[model samples]
Structure formats: structure tokens, C-alpha cells
Target chain A: MTSTTLTPSFDEQYVATRKVATVGRVEISDVTKSYGANTVLRDVSLTIEPGQVVALIGPSGSGKSTLLRAINHLETVDRGSITVDGRYIGYERKGDTLHELREAEILRRRTQVGLVFQNFNLFPHLTAIENIIEAPVAHKRLTRDDARALAEGLLARVGLADKADHYPRQLSGGQQQRVAIARALALSPKVLLFDEPTSALDPELVGEVLDVIRGLARDGTTLVIVTHEIGFAREVADRIVFLDHGEIVEQGTPGQVLRNARHRRTRDFLAKVL
Target chain B: MSRIVAPRSETTAHAAGAATPATDADATTDDTTSASSATADAVAKSGPAGGRLDAGLRVVPVKHWGRWVLSAIVAFVILQFLWSLATNPQWQWDVFAEYFFAPSVINGLWLTLGLTVVAGVAGFVLGAVLAVFRLSKSPLLGAAAWWYIWFFRSVPLVVQILVWYNLGYLYPTLGLGTPFTTDFWIVEFPTTTLISAFAAAAIGLSLHQAAYSAEIIRAGILSVDQGQLEAAGALGLPRSIRFFRITLPQAARAIVPNAFNEIIGLVKGTSVVFIVALPELFYTVQVIYNRNQRVIPLLLVAVVWYALITTVLSIAQYYVERRYARGSVRELPPTPVQRARRWGAEQWNRLGDAHTAAAPPPPAQPEPVVTAAAAASDQYRTGGAA
Candidate 1:
């Protein structure tokens, strides 16, 4: 459980000799997922450019989270494929057959993509700075010193500079969520995904988390946010996609989707929440 | 469902204007058919006698007779056992004192401790690998772990030890190399010359311990929240990284408690090595008793040593469990040292209480009283006040 002891030897070499990696555009095509007879997602397809921000909004169980998960290869598709930066995710396409990627390849690819979750999912045992540097130093092979500096910069970015030594349990919900953001940003991933980042926070604590995501959006980080906050989405997202019954109900600019949605389901859902 | 039924009962209770809070809770759980029937029976008896009295001035000082009776019985039994042990002549207290720290007995105790630690560590390491194999994605790996656990756990340790001791008879020579190949890189040795009785016993003990440890570790791994694995996956960490970094640390919270349980079991389990003629504590005590015929005292030596070891291990288990319980629970419970300190202070205060009896009690503070109607309303809203 002592993370400092588990830092791999390659960390120094990878950080000292390598250049920063870039994240690529994401492509998810005709992806479908199911558990037993219950279909979670059905033939979903979407494309996000390198620096574009897209917000996915939906009612509970509408498959928005599943679609976001499929993009990062967390949940594999039963049919069709997804690619990031022109390379197939989780699998390699050779001729007509597809072969799953090896563990090393998958890890190397993960450095450019990061995920932040509703519960923060920060390693409760580690301090804030340690949590931020864990993946970078352990998997990405960033040297200990370099990872520390990067983590410190990220803590400052998230307005948690004084909380580097605090454990997740010691931090408030908003602070923990901000620390999670810092951890995700540690690797300078090109794409960042948030799944209901503020849903676990109290009403008053929700604004701080939204502000951090707003900061990321202003910096042009390619983000796919699955959220229930209609107001936050309209303010931060360039495009909003409404999902219902495992399908996209409507997708357009904030003005078009939020104010002038043509779909009946979208309007009904908007009416209830708004 | 509760929302629909709760209001009807609440209104009826209000109409009676003196209903106890018990019926309010009963109405919420009325969805259970059996419970509703019980509620109906209780409702039928909601007469003036069943009405709730005022809260502020009313004092219901119920005594817990069951707790006191059980505590007294337990205390009497323990005291009687201690009294018997002190007065009994058959115990041979002098002989026990003489043999307790004998060089032979001390060596045997040391051997028992050593064997427990060495075998316990080796077994746990082996079991951890098997556990990971059982949990591995590959079917072949899972099958290998499953079969090993099954075989080891099924066989008796005594039988295993005896079989290993006699293995040399079945196989004259044992070697590590590719079978049927001319290149014998791993040198062959006569099995009788290489395998000793002590080594055989250790192997049997470790293998037996491993089967149990593997299951315990697997249960620990299974206890971790699945969302943790999902989030780590979404972060694009490699399989190994995901496991060592995220999975193992979180799983440690679950693994440490049962793992220590196995270690404590292994400590006493070392006594079974007497079948192999190994000089562990119990075996040494048996050897002494056979020579001197101080039967009860010699057996007491083994019992005392075991009790001491188990007590130490129990304390260790408590602290280890507390260490891993961080973040999972609201707060970690106090350590044994802190609890002992507090107990000592309380006992000291009790002993000195008579000297301070002449001191006047602290001036009575003004009692804040609520209107009976207000208190009744508060209790009514909560269903039942704690």
C-alpha cells in the first residue's frame, strides 16, 4: 500500500528521455453492449475532434454513461469498433480479423486518456499529491521528481495547492473531486472524461466542481461529460446530445438542443429538470 | 408504497390524539403482509391504555435484568474455575514451575514459533499466487489454481506428512529437469538423502495452510467495490498496473483480517507435527511427560504457551484490521493501548471515589423543559425516538 515503494525503475528513463504524448480524435462506431437480455447501449456512434467538448445528457439508465465508457474501451462493444488517434482501442485490426491488444500496449495508450468519476475514486490511502502521481509514475514511467512537479502544478491548477498532503477522507466532497481532476490531469491526457462529477456533491458544493470543469473547457481539453446538470451543460458545452432509451434523442448546439429541441422526449425531460 | 399507507395511519393516530409512536413505524412496514396483520392486531388494542403519556415529566426507567443475570453467571463460573485451579493438588504446581522454562521446553517453543512463521509466510505467498490464478481471466490458469486448492484442502495434514516422509520409497531419485531428455541440467539426487522428516513436515503444513489461504485471499479480492476496477479500467491502465496499483491496495482492506485469522490458526496447527516426530511444543511436552510422568503439569506447559501466543496474535489482528479500515468506515476505532489506558483511569477514579464522597455534587443546572404537546409532536413525527 506504500505507493512510493512501488515506483518502477523505468519511470526515470521514460520521463527523462521522452517527449510529451498527444491525445488523438475519438471515433466510436456502431457500438452495442448488453448484460443478459437487457441492452444497455444499441448501435451507438459518435465522433469527437481532438479538442472539442461534447456534453452527453440523459435520464437515468439512458446509456449515456455506457457510451462514454465504450469510447475509452472500458466496456468492449459487441459489434463495430472505436478508434482514438487512428488506432483501434482495446483491439488491433489486421485484415478482416481483430486481435485484442497486449497489456503493455493498452497501458501505453492510457497515458493520453483519463477518466474522473462521480465518487472521486481517488486512492483513499494515498495523499492528494500521491494519488495524482500514481498512474504517471507507476504506469506512464514519469520519474519521481518530474511526477511530483507535475502533480504540484496540477494541484495549483485545481486550487488545491495547500491540500497536497491531505488524504481523500480529510477533504470535502468538492475538494476531493477537484483532487480527482488534478490526478486525471497529471499525465496531460488529451482527452478527459467526467461521469457525473458533481452528482455526489451537496448542492452548495456542486459549484466548485463545475468551476474546475469549466476551467478545463476554457483550456480546450477534449472532454466528454455525462451529466444530469442541464444548467452546467448549457453553460460549458459547445454541443449537447440528449439520449433516451439507449439511443440519441437529439444532438445540436446548446441553443438548439436546450431551448429549441424538436424531439418530444427531449422536451419532456428538459421540462422536468429545468 | 409506504407513502400511500403512512398518511392514513398518521391521521387515524392523530384522531385518537394519544397514539404511541410504535404504531407509526408499524404502518410504514405494512407492505409486508404478515407485518400488516400484526399491525392490525396491535391497532385493535389501541385503547386509552395504549395511549402515549407525556414526554417531559414522564420517566420510564426500565431495568435490563437479562444483562445483569447473564454477567453474574459468567463471572461466577470463571471464579469457580480459578478457585479450583488454585486449590487442586493434582495440578502439581511445583513441577509445572520447574519444567516451564526448561532448556528442552524453551527450544521446543522456539521451534514451534519458527515453524509457524516460516510455514505461514511461505503458504501465504504461494496462496496469493494461486488466488490471482483463480481470479485470472484465462480459463487454464483458473483451472490450475482450482485443482490445487481442491486437492490440498481435501487431504488430511497427517496423511500428507506421512506420504511425503515415505516418498523416497516410491521414487529412488528426484530431479528438476525436462523429463525423458538427455540434457539433465538439474542434477538428480537420491530422494532419501535429500528429504528429511522436518522438511517433509514443513511442506505438509505449508501446503495445507495454502489451500485455506487461497480461498481467504479470493474472498478478500471479491469484497472490493467493482466500481473501483471499472474506474481504473476507464483510466486506460494496463492489466498489471490496474491490479498492483488499484486492486491490491483496496483488496488489502478485505484480505488482512482473514489472512491474520489463518496465521493464528497456523500457530496452533503446528502442534499436529507430532505425527511426524518433529519436536514442536506439544510434542516436546509429551516427551517430557512420558519421562517424568508429571502428566497434568506437562500438558499445562503446552496450554500456557499456546494461550500466550494466541493472545499476542489476537492483539496484532485487531491493530492490522484497524489499519486497513481507513476511508471504508467513518472513523477508525481506538487502539488497544488507548482502551487500556482509559480503563486504568476509570478504575483509579473508582478506587478513590470514597475519599471524594464528602464533596458537594455540582450545582444542579437549570433543566430545559419542553411543553408536553410539543414533545409528543416531536416523538410522533420521528415514529419512535431513540
Candidate 2:
């Protein structure tokens, strides 16, 4: 409430804004992951240029969400590397040795890559603005007033300025998801990932949440969205990657992929989903 | 109003059975007319009867003979006990009050309260550590906690104090020294000097209380959701922040009630220290009664003191529980002070309601001060703005 102005001071503390207008080039190379004998991801490789909005569309258990999590190193790849904006996440490579970074390094890198969960895991104990301001004050080196100012700006951006003091339970599922997105954006991460963000919401609530993501896409935030909303993906994403059975079956521009998917797995999956 | 009818409340069938004027043919005709008229209505409204059972079936009210008999029996027993207490000289009330505030007895009560505080604090601190150890990720640490609780909880507190008192026979001297050889690093104090009766009592009581407290704390920790821990991990908050901010606050709601139960028990349990000749309240009462040969009155004095302490502890536990129970409820239940105020406000409002109803409340009868508590729930908003 004290600092309502979105001054340059708050913007300067953001990692994304400080980057030289060139950020979030995510690289995934030869990535493989498994839980026990059941491999969840297999030899998945993709590249995203700065400000490119990519949509990963697939059925359950297809490793589409796993691929999104790998970009932030929330899940480590068994045999490959994921780098966002040319910096290795979770692991540091020195010549042939790829040693896992310490927890502090992982947390520091995590502050730069934001992940929004399907459940919208807003801390239940904190109010909406507190949730938004927590990471910025803790990790972004922003003062309390500046963090509050930045959080207010983010909340206003998400069309929730009036909900500053409301607890998470007091908000609807869609509203809570938007608050979660605001919280992720608080530190101004270079890359943003959304995992089935609308799947947990009711059909009526899905549009408001989708509108928030659409606004982010319009404003040119680097986004990797794993979603089942085909029309939304077609409208918002620059490129669409379709996966089935733990491998990327096809990928192209939205029209090219959505209209005429070449692979059988991609077509069959789209046939059911669409 | 009826041309041919029995009394208003009597069953039609009963009246018909008593009738000498109506023939079987007339009765059959009446039954046929009524049956066809409301056959569907009978099944729906009265389960195969067109009206209530009182209209067609014989019924009578039963007196509550059992209730009267039970009430009489309870009143008789209570009256007999009161009569004996009032008339008998053997149960000397005068003797009870004479030694109740005696200096020696007061000192014993003071010592008892001191022991309760010391043992309760030490027990809870050790118990908290053991609870954390029980839940530690390392299997060795968890097993060590489990074994300590198992051993201490199994042994009797009185026996433990006795063993500590006679420890000189076993250890002879207690000090920091290298094991298996006599390479003493510090001065060795004699066992008798180290563990006096008071020390033995405190140690035994604290150890016994600790084992029970550990389980209460462990259960509280386990009650917090696993999702909260995962959420903290994903947020990249360090382990310390996660525990202090996320886990322990939530666990406290579950832990407080059980902890108070242990503390209240410890206050009463301190009387057992007398086994090691540490003269707490129970031993003090015994010593005086044995001299004067007025056992019942001296015992009554101990009971009264213990009851008073129990009442204070119980009140403290209530407020502590309320404090921790915040945020779990929508509006915290009114505190005892607020409740009393609200009750007073409600009585005044009821007088206003009676005045408006144009009927003065009876001056002779007892006023309804003890109405249902929910009636006062709306007025509870006065003091909880903070």
C-alpha cells in the first residue's frame, strides 16, 4: 500500500528486465529420465529462442510436463543437459565432468526460472500479496517497499489489485492460479513454465486463467506451457510440440502442426484431444 | 355435532364394539363408504389408515414410573451421605482446617509446586529433542530415541527414584573419567553427594515425563501434510525456514492438548517423590496424620490443595489451547472473558424483548440467565476485533 508506483527501481531488481533484452534461450539436449525401470522421458531435445512462446501438448503420462520441468531442472535429466539463457540449470559442466550444483546454486538458478504448478500451490498461510512478494524480498535483493511495489504492479497486471489482502482459499481456483503466476513472476524469472494450469480448474473458470497467460504471451515473456487447451495453444504459441509415449512425435508452427500433423502418434493424440 | 357419535377422542372402532344399537350391517356400510373415499390417502398419510391411530386404534398415555423411581433412589443416597457428613464427629472438619495452613504443610506444598515446575520443564525440553531424533532421517538416531522412550516409560517412576537414591552402592563415585581405567579428567564427586533425595526425585520424575512427552510431540510432527514440505522444497526455501515457518506452527495445534495433559499429570505425579523421602504434600499430610491419628482430615487437606492446583492448571491450559487454535477457525471462539460479557449483554437484551412483548417477566421465578449459549453467539463480536 505504501509504494504504488511501478518505478524503474523495482524493474531494475528483476532478472528478466536486467538481461540485455535478449533472454530465455532454453536448450535441451539428449535428455533421458526414468523412475526405476519405467522411463518417463526419452532422448528429448528442443531449443527455444528468446521470447519464443512454445506450447507442449500431449495426453497424460506422455512426458510433456516432464520436459517443461526439465527446462528449470525441477527434474534432472539422466543423460543430457538443460540450459536456459546459456546457463546450465541444476548441474554445472566442466569439460567431461557434469557435477550437480549445490542446493544454494540450484535455489539461485531457480529464482530465475519460474514454474507454475497445475494445483497453483499458493502458500495457504500467506495472503495474495505476501505470496507475490516473498521471493523478491528474499532472493531478488529488493527492499520491502520495493518488493511490495513490484508485487502490487504484478497483481494489477493480473487484474487482481483489489485482492491484495485475501487469503488463497478466499479466491476462486482461476484467481488462485493467477496469483500463483504473479508469485512466479515476482522475481522476474528469465523463463516461465506452466504445467496443465487450467486442467484443475472448472470449465467456466478456465477462460480467466487462459486470458492471463495470453496477456503474458502478448507482452513477450518467454513461456513454455504444457496444456490440453488446443485452441488456446493454437492462438498463443509460436510453435507447437506434440508428444506421445515419452517422445516428441512432431513439432512445427501451430497451423502446420494442428492442421496437418505428419506423424501417426501426433494425429491420433490430436484426434482424441481435439 | 354428530347425530350418532361416541366421545370426541375415543376410537370409532372401540365405540362400535361397545355399541348395542348399531347392527353389523350398519357398521359394514359405514366402513365401506369411508374406505373407498380415502384409500390412497390412508396409505400415504397414516400408513394404511385414513387418519391418525387415535381415530381408529386404542391408545393410552404411560406414566414414567422408572424415571420417578430412579430420581428417588439418587436423592435418598445423596441425602444419607450429607446427613452422615453433617452429624458425624469422626469426620472432623475442624481438624482439616487446623493443619491446612500449618507452616510445615505450607512448605511441603511449596516444594511440591517447585518440583512440578522443574521436572515439567526439563522433561518437555528433553522430550522435544527425543521427538526430533525419533523423526530424524538417520536410522541410528531414530532407533536411539525409540530405545530411550521404551526403557524409561516401562519402568515405574517410584522405583526409578529409589534406584537413583541407592546409586552409591553401584557407582560409588560419579564424575567425568575415561572408561575401563581410572584416568579421571575432572574431580570425582561422591555419588551420595551428587544425588541427594531431592535430586533423585527430580531426575526420576523428569525422565518418566520425557518418554510420554516424546510420543505427543512426534505425533504432532507427523500430523502436518507432506504436500507442505514438497511445496517448500519447490519454493527453494532452505530447510530451516521450511521447518520453522511451515511445519512447527501447523504441528503446534495438534501438540498443545497432549502436552497440557502431561503437565497436569506431572503436578499430581510429584506426590510419588515421597518414596525417596522427598517430603512433598502427600508425605507431609501422612506425617501429621500419623502423629495426631486424624487420617481422614489430613488427607482431605491434601485433596483440597491438589484440587486447587489442578483447577489453576486446567484454566491455564484452556487459554493456551485457545491461543494456538487461531487461524484454524474462521473467528476464534469467544474467550471466557468475552463469553461472560456476552452473557450479560444477552440477559439485558432479553429484558428488552420481554418489555416489547407487553408481558413483564415474572419477579418471583428465577430469571433465565442460563439460556443456550448459541443464542449469545451473535453478540460475541464485541471484543475480538484484534
Q: What does the lDDT read for residue A269 in candidate 1?
A: 95
**Model 1 lDDT at residue A215:** 65
Candidate 1 differs from the real structure by a C-alpha RMSD in angstroms, to one decimal, of 11.8
True contacts kept of each: 0.47, 0.08
CA deviation > 4 Å runs, candidate 1: A1-24, A33-43, A92-99, B1-73, B177-186, B339-386
Task: Provide the overall lDDT of each model, using Cα atoms, as 2-decimal numbers.
Answer: 0.79, 0.79
The residue pairs in collision within model 2 are none
* Per-residue lDDT of candidate 2, residues A1-274 (tens digit): 2112322233213324422337888998888999889898889899988888899998899999888877777677788788887778787888888788898788777777888889887766677898887776666479989999989898887778999888787788988998999988887877889999999999988877877787676566788999999998887788999887788889999989999988888888888989
Say which docking band candidate 2 falls in: incorrect
> What TM-score, computed on C-alpha atoms, does each candidate reach?
0.77, 0.73
Candidate 1: residue A67 lDDT (0-100):
83
Which TM-score value belongs to model 1?
0.77
Clashes of each: 0, 0
Model 2, B123-174: lDDT tens digits are 9889989999999989999999999999998998889999999999998888
